[model samples]
Target: MNPPEPAHTPQPDVVAAMRGDLADWRQWLARVIVLAYAAAAGLSVVAFSKLCDLAQQGFASVLAFNPWTPLVWTSACTAGVVWLTRRFAPAAAGSGIPQVMATLDPAVPAEARRAFVSLRLSVMKAVLTAGSLLGGLASGREGPSVQIAAGVMQHARRWLPPHPGISEHGLLVAGGAAGIAAAFNAPLAGVMFAIEELASRLEQRSSGLIIAAIVLSGLMGVSFFGNATYFGTIEVPTLRYSMWWPALLLVLATGGLGGVFARLLHASITGQGDRLGRWRAAHPVAFAAACGLAAGAIGIASHGASFGSGYGYTRGLLQGHVDVPLLYVTLRVVATWLAVWSGVPGGIFAPCLAIGAGVGHDVAVLCGAQADASALIALGMAAFLAAVTQAPMTSFIIVMEMVGGHAMVLSLMAAALGASLVSRWIARPLYAALAQAIIARGRLAPAVAAPSR
Candidate 1:
């Protein structure tokens, strides 16, 4: 007792070593978290896809007998679902990319956190998106996949170590990126999307976390879905000198059409608080039913081509098995517009690619270069998506991955850059502008939220 206790001390060398070890451990933990997110998101999206596919089959079954019956049934169901979503889980409404983009902003990360990234909202999104598919809406599930993954990872924060360096924004971006990687099995595209579409500033995201997350999520996808290009493979050889003419024509055609589509969609959603917009906001359920009716009418006219996500039609076009009519592209575009304007929980990625394929087919016929249909279709997909998102890099990379090769990189690049330039004439960017509006709404009305997930 009389002996003075030696003062506790740490050797500088030993302390430095400890700090280094701690940093490494933190990084290791971050990787583990990302992997966990990847596995969960991949498995969940796969299951969701299966269920939605089954629902689409049911819609097809209904359509086989009488289109009118299905039309009325779908409209009623659409109205009911939209009502429920608005009254209860408002967050599960439209393509969720905008919500994720809004919340990831460094300036207002906390504004939409509780509303958009909650576990409860994720569950609602899953259920509602499936319901929308069952209603015969022209919708895709990928957008909901992004929201679910982000929400899951954000909620899993409780399990992470209580380190001072832990960052919520980093986790959100990683989760969203992982979701896209798993959804399309495109890892690099996922990272670019996070940077190009989600975060407004580099400091808001953790690049290390995004890479780790994408690898894990993409691996899970490769394991479950196999390593096939999402749109199936294309055997593109060296382009003939004559192929350039059709390719160039396709670039302008797709770019102009996509730009107009993007501008129209933007105007419909954010119509400067005009009469139509105000009426839509005031009577959302009625308007959603009407939109569903219009989509159903388009599907009837297209002989069922306008139903579901249009994935099967597009894939068939790629494999040279489906001979789609020229009018199908215009009808499908109308269907997509109706469904999107309805604010249903779905994505436009699959539909846009399908429409692009249709456009390519027509352009090929007009240019008498139908022999290279697949290449033209691929180019159109890249071009239209680039114009829509104003993300040429992400669009080109995703298209390349979807096609499973680099043979068309140069061509895809040409289409993407050209389309992006044309799109600038219409608007700044679709996703970025929507994201800004969402952030403003989140702060003004915390209870109001609308997205796919």
Candidate 2:
């Protein structure tokens, strides 16, 4: 009682502990670790981008040698790449966004999650995706970039302390956001993608980490690629009230087609009660070779415009510098679907956008809105993406950032939302459905193996 009256002096150790709590070395270290991995992931993506460019250039050289080179070359190379994917990294196949989504899901077993985002799987994904492009497959790098970045950030979980504020889910989301930011050089779009596509909801604790990752990774991307939009800006005419009908028509058209494409892709990938899918599952390599040959034939018919990611073709169309055949959309869609159906490591983003551009160009010509074709092309790009992914916010934001089409923001929004709504009636949300399939497969594996044991 007397000691209490005299007021107990604070113990030095206790005071030091309080001070240490304020310092929070572990918390700081966790932040540092997250940031370091994010930068590394961004740089890795930049390197991958370079690899893909080289691959595309290499394929262009090959295609120039002979218009039919892809028939033999693409077939053989696709067979080899698919074999490698199946033999070494089955998880590396496809756009990989589904795998990332599955990893973030709690229902996916911990073992399956690790396998999905493992560094080894990521390396295979990059190499095989580059190989796919080198073989003249119609694929994009953006979706694979998301998975690669997530895998890189997944490694941080090992180094980080068990802190509530820093979760594996947050890291994966941050990594994916960083990937998009770095890939497109669009930080705001990355954030929107994180919230809209990657994470269902952005928690308060993870928001800072997500932003930091995007900033760090975005800086790295800017360092390597400069601060330019992915598609570069276009001189869009000031939109008028008369333009509304054309925009609506473009949205409906692209959204409907995009939905069909998504449905077909999902059915093929899941191998669900389809004869062609069953054949694909049974003879993956042979199926891939056939897809390559078919896609190659289509590319020859399109004068090689349907091969690779269709980036140059899409950009040229956007700039009104190139005129594709009326059948370009049909050729591109079939070729892209074939490539994706092959189960090789590739993405549909660029190819999908290319298809949309073709659709828009055709719609404008048919509707006698040629003057606003550029704007419609841009709208079609956004609309198709939104329709396919069912993520209108992410789609419009990404397209807006890629093209610097701020003047057409409202139009872009209307197109994106309208297309997404239209798509819903045609197909389920693509990535989410794919992710669920992945989770189902993962759960079945253990149970199926238990019977064997």
Most accurate candidate by TM-score: 2
Clashing residue pairs for model 1:
93-451, 94-451, 94-452
lDDT of 2 by residue, 41-150 (tens): 89988988999999999999999999889899999889999999999988889998988887787655567688888777778888999999999999999899999999
TM-score of candidate 1 to 2 decimals? 0.89
List the lowest-lDDT window of 10 residues for candidate 1: 444-453
Clashing pairs counted in every model = 3, 0
Candidate 1 lDDT, 175-263, residue by residue in tens: 77777777788888878877777764444345665567666766777887888887777878569999888888887887788888888
TM-score of 2: 0.93
Stretches > 4 Å off in candidate 1: 1-19, 22-27, 109-111, 164-166, 200-206, 442-453
